[model samples]
Target: MTAVRVLLADDEHLIRGALAALLALEDDLVVVAEAASGAEALAMARAHRPDVAVLDLQMPGGPDGVKVATSLRDELPSCRTMIVTSHGRPGHLKRALSAGVRGFVPKTVSAQRLAEIIRAVHAGNRYVDPELAADAISAGDSPLTAREAEVLEFAADGAPIAEIAERASLSQGTVRNYLSAAAAKLGAENRHTAVRLARERGWV
Candidate 1:
């Protein structure tokens, strides 16, 4: 049987090393390359043309993992991709699916399970962590309005209401109104809570 060539990409050194070790144990899997950033991952993928590429959603460089996956899908059609990240945000899942990634695995999942997911994706099957899938479905059910989402995204950075208002090109009163509406829609007690909930639900 032919071995599966794999390229692993993640920002953290320890996590990358541990994942490489875990995947190395798989008799049919070969770690062809490792990347510490999105740019490096893309370069390595292009160079090695691995059977599977494991990417982290958040990484340094202009294009993220989703963008890298999209490129790989277009440029190396035979290479499959799996997104591994600590963030299980619904937006991230949506983006990964849209980018044509074959699998989505949360960082919290066991390394053995991650290897299974990689193999599954390489075999042309789709995989989504059960917990993330549930969160995505729930987020779809309770969608946020476009304006509300914008406000919450700005708020997440600890931006003051006035600053948010100015950046969003709205009056202070308008900003407050948007925040109140978003809070109510999210069943949150305050704007901060609303922002947190929105992010968790992938509204922002």
Candidate 2:
């Protein structure tokens, strides 16, 4: 029987290494590539053309897992995709599903369970953590527009309006407008509350 080729992408070194090691023990699985960033994951996936790509949800310095999965769906439709996140949010799960991810599980899942999930994904089945799916059902959709969410993410660090404008490449007035609109939509009294609410819902 042919082994399933897998690509593992995660920014955390220890976790990535441990996962790689554990997955190597599976008789029907082989780790074909490992990457520490989303960009690298894409590159590795292109080069290796693995049967499955298991990605971390919050890799730094590039697109997140959902974005990578979306790209892979376009560029490599045969390659199945899955996400493993330490921080699973309702909105994120929804985004992953929309991006055509076949599996979404928390990082706390055991290696044995993850291996089984990988097999399931390769067989074209979908799996989402039950708790996360329940939360996503309850959280509903985000009301904020793309621009509003982008501006709010810029404001997450409590930066000044001028700085946010510079970062977002918009005028201060525009930044304020987006923030205000976002706050109003979320029923937040202020932008800070808006940011907090959006973050808790994983909209930003």
Computed on alpha carbons, the lDDT of every model, listed in order, comes to: 0.88, 0.95
Best by TM-score: 2
Q: What TM-score, over all chains together, does every model reach? A: 0.86, 0.90
lDDT of 1 by residue, 1-204 (tens): 898999999988998998899889989899999999988998999899999999988887667789899999899999999899887888789888988998998889887888888888988999998899988887774457788788788888888998999889999998899899999998999999998887777667
Residue 77 displacement (Å), model 1: 3.3
Q: Name the top lDDT candidate.
A: 2
Deviation (Å) of 97 in candidate 2: 1.6
Instruction: Return the lDDT, model 2, position 188.
Output: 97
| Candidate 2 overall lDDT versus native | 0.95
Q: Which ten residues in a row have the lowest lDDT in candidate 2?
A: 129-138
Worst 10 residues of 1 by lDDT: 137-146
Q: List, in order, the clash count of every candidate structure.
A: 0, 0
